[model samples]
Target chain A: MAESRRPLPRPTPETQHFWDGTRERELRLQRCDACSQVYFPPRPFCPACASRKVSVFAASGRGTLYSYVINHRAPPGSGFEPPYSIAVVELDEGPRMMTNIVGVPQTPEALQLDMPVEAVYEDFTDQITLPFFRPLEAS
Target chain B: MRPGSVAIVGAAETTELGRIPDQSQLQLHADAALNTLADAGLTPADVDGVATAGESPTGVAHYLGITPTWVDGTAVGGCSFMLHVRHAAAAINEGFCKTVLITHGESGRSRIGRGGFSRPAASLQGQFEAPFGTMGAPSTFTIPVLRYMKKYGVTEEQLAMVAVVQREWAARNPRASYRDPIDVDDVLSSDMIAYPFRKLMCCLVTDGGGALILTSAERARDFPQRPVYVIGTGESVETPMVSQMEDFTTSRAFRVSGRAAFEEAGIAHGDVDHLMIYDAFAHLPLYGLEDLGFVGRGEAADFVEERNTAEGGKLPLNTNGGGLSYMHSGMYGMYALQESVRQLRGTAPAQVKDARISIAHGVGGMFAASGTIVLSNEAR
Candidate 1:
């Protein structure tokens, strides 16, 4: 409920496309044209090859919970409820991103490693939509 | 090119360790420098080389009223001082300067005259990681630790023992901020700051600083105190942010720096008499032990849990109580170096009997950077 007080990120020119895609509920990833390597956090060139010939593309928005921590203490008045989880999710394209696990109890029992998760967007502002992760339900 | 060509002639911490709300950050640096200068039987004029981190070396040199022929300000993180020692040794060997002085001071607890770091909103960490409500060191450091716990099956109780053992060492040191005995249960029940990490697992926030003086091995014996020969030194950097570490289970910088130092010193693991690993968190020592090849991968936890690194154990670690029980003034590396010097000089409160060789390894910016120094009481 204390969503408004959470720290918000301001996108730079290098990461504008990724942030813009979040507003449309799309997870954007940078793929290297030379090596076909996909990387996260939206870098201009490929981390593997350092090639500037990279393209931003809509990702599958699906990933697995690689690792996480359940924070019991929140900064005073930060609006983050206690027992919330901060996590690193490994995307299907072979890149990882830091996010929060939502739509489930923020506990070790609920947020197991390697659990399937999908991206969910919360529009904190008209220009910014932070991407979070939620457990994927079996079809 | 010899490893023991340079030696540490003087080492001392701030007059007071735990809390000094009145002293500014620079004054703390000056106090430690003056103490070390007195210990070395030298004055500011004798300090021809200077190095520091968190604060500008120029500022330290100017305030101490000394002009240096050589200066290094390598601020990689908390481990900056370790790198400074390595650089100072190289500088001295190259005849850049004869006597090198390295100082570290931070008013972390008091926040008195400490510099602030602000990144542009578009910066890599600012854009990617900081926006996600990641709290400072406590929260960011947990990223890899959680993975390490799951991958290696490290139990919470095992991690708690790190604090318990270090506290046992702390009980002996009079300058230690926390000398009370603590148990695994005490650490487990302490306030959970971040998941998988309790308050006891984190380092104590205190205001203090330490200084070191290094000169040629030829002039080392001329000094008043027992010179701790700097046999080997290595320094390296990995990533600026913990979230970007190459691996979650191990620190690449630790391996690089430790291996280089071991190779330079030509000493085996069994030869080490005392060890000091920068323990900003309990997990760091675990990584340092394994990554430095002291113990096999995945065996460090059991090694520590079995009381190997505790008092009277096969390998006594953190004899000055370490950052966990001693005083951590932001940059904890300087204090680690000071403890190593103390152990080599046969003057540590929790001295290891007949301890000849001490290795001081430090991590800066989580696992982002590392520096390792090998010291010996006698020059071969």
Candidate 2:
């Protein structure tokens, strides 16, 4: 039963490195060497400029909770429970990522937008660990 | 642009619209494809390319008994079908195939193959929003509409104004399913499906099928119809994840695509005669109006209030009743383009009187991808 839970998107050639980094418990951003723009969707080249000079870089893995929604439906093969916080995290390195705000009470008031959050990796297997986020209290 | 203009010469549908019989998804697709070919005065043998949507094990090309040079089953969102027109046009322009048929069949009314594509959420989207009960298209779109209403200070009356006006337009359209004219009060009072969006604002899913036969403008001369030239098109994607979208009040994708389409067509906004924006919900037109640059930002409600967007107004829109009242075959994008073509032909049941220029706009994937097409009397 545990073996059936597969991530919805099996990363393709363009995004395999990004997913691999996720599994390795490191947040990697595809940074364009030509323009210094970090891309969330790892691509063949820089979207800002048509330059193919782009490389993956490990980010600080700290970010702010940008926005989120709580999904109730049980998607096929997705073992997540209802009422979990799915969100966009604005990374410290400036790239916004689609992720979940985990280990926090799920409510609009509790899950405030722009709340400071940091990434925590949950290793499921040797090749797959999801990067979930938690609220980082402002010091 | 090079001279390879894909003209939609034929269009047909099998809208078991009001009360669709229990036909399989494949049967609906086959019927629509055959009907479209007959309408175009051709047969399945004459077609070389087939583009389709819906969960049918039999691929469209194999079902149609012809081999296509290109097969695009990109299931991005409901509006992905409109995106296919642009893809088909480019393919036709590139001399890949001559006759391209784009089609869609869905038993949404019956929920065939329910949860067919609801696989695991990956690519960080699952990590963030998928767990939080922030689910599905209607609910995802609802939050943004709420934000639009909130940020713009749009009242419920103004939001309902879209439905009142749409009902009016739908009344004239024989193809429209819901003919009962609704007022602002009716829209406001209707059962709230999601906050800010009432049952009236949401599109009624109907079991329907739509088919389009696209051929070069040069090939259009031989057909028994006026050639609606594919002038200019632009499609853009913002984010597949709803939570990642930058703004809820407006669509960034539409803004991007609108500029590109306007530039490609070399036409000004004021020059547009007919507008066919996807009205999956009332707020869609609101978002579309703002991002399409028709009205000032956050003023789409006022734009509708001023009666600038209704039929017989300065800007006549959704002449074939739109998806709100018309049969929505899951993907409303193809329907929008088909209606635009019908308007240009002066043959639509709800024709926009001599529509020389028509804009076919589609909003898809929780406002992720927007595609715009500017079809004129001829390529200017």
Candidate 3:
């Protein structure tokens, strides 16, 4: 079998570390050695300080929902499904991530603005996994 | 840097807005491109530079049967072509080419019903966001609009004013999709797509093509008719993905580009007699109002609610109905420039009285890129 000819994003040189770290079920963040600004989508330099001296570090993977939308339309591709919760999450590391909001009903009636959520990595393949979020219970 | 004057010497539109069953995507682009050349009294040989985004240009290049000296296929966002137009002007000024042609076409209204090309930035948005029933534009844009309401003390009635005003402009044009008169009550009472934005608040997708011919001031003066000078133009890009945006309430990209355009044109924002802003949604103008320094933060609601953007109001916005009512093939910004050219030419049926100086704005990928072009009657 050709592994069902799945539609998975192939990591490029610009984003290899991000994919590799995700495979091992860890959230790696790129930090600017100059300004110490932690960022996502691994790049060559710091966005804030424009320093080339950047390093990767493990993140706590804890963040809160900044904003979200429920897409009722289906995206292109075989594995795609509709009515998903696409969200903008503000990580504790001061970086905002764009990911899906899960483990809750995808509805305008259910989704609340600025709600608390946490990241959990799901292994989809031996070489790939994704960091998805679930609702955090009230402390 | 100051560039030579550029005029919208030619402009044209396709048959329908939302969907056209009989035509291919390339056919739409070809029809408009060829028609615009005919309108300007030029041929394929006259165009040495071509710029476009949205779809690949292999077919368009083949259909037109003319190779370009410089061709830009940068696909940043819907307004990426607007950024391309600015680059085209720079190319013309440097003598890279004489006549630059800009065009866009899409079968979105037909092929996918509500489809979009594979956007590079959208991957920043996960597929998991869909199963939760994400309503696309309603979820992405309306959320920030809600934050606007909370911060600015703007009422729903104020937001409705944008839709009402555009409807008035759309009604004047025979080709507008939402041309029927819709009152403030109708706008307010329409079903909510996202909490803050209602049905009437969003733009309609139309299957069509739009393009323009831009030339140097001297070359334009030698042509058949008057040449509208591009006094000043500026562009800026922020976080391409919405997730990377620092603040939803403020558009930093708009603010930066607005300043550059104003400074380059040597004109105050208040000096603009006519305005043509991208209206992917009726609420989009509020972003322009604040970004252009037309109103203070959160004051856009009240400013628009007072009907300041209406046809007879101080600012006559989107005379050809805008993307909300006109055409949203891919890059609505190209049409924004075209509509302003019409109004300045006194050809717009909904033309503002004695309209001269105009401002055209384009919002690229997910509100990511912004470009402002100032058009005037005389060469600056």
TM-scores, all candidates, are: 0.97, 0.78, 0.86
Q: Give the number of the best model, judged by DockQ.
A: 1
The candidate with the higher DockQ, 1 or 3, is 1
**What's the i-RMS of each model?**
1.4, 5.1, 5.3
Residue A84 of model 3 has an lDDT of: 64
Candidate 2 residue-wise lDDT, A3-101, digit = tens = 426354456677778778877778888888999888776687997897999999989889886555454444655566655655667788877776767
Total residue pair clashes for candidate 3 = 21
Model 2, first chain, TM-score of 0.85
Residue-by-residue lDDT tens digits, candidate 2, B258-302 = 888888777888888999899888778888878888888888888
Give TM-scores of chain A for all candidates: 0.95, 0.85, 0.84
Q: Put the candidates in lDDT order, highest first.
A: 1, 2, 3
Q: For model 1, how big is the iRMS in angstroms?
A: 1.4
Better of 2 and 3 by lDDT: 2
Instruction: Name the lDDT value of residue A124 in candidate 1.
Output: 80
Q: In model 3, which runs have C-alpha deviations exceeding 4 angstroms? A: A1-26, A74-84, A103-112, A121-129, B1-4, B15-18, B55-59, B112-116, B119-143, B154-157, B183-197
How much does candidate 2 score in TM-score? 0.78
The DockQ-based order of candidates, best leading, equals 1, 3, 2
State the fraction of real interface contacts model 1 keeps: 0.65
TM-score of chain A of 3: 0.84
In model 2, how large is the Cα lDDT of residue B6?
69
TM-score of 1: 0.97
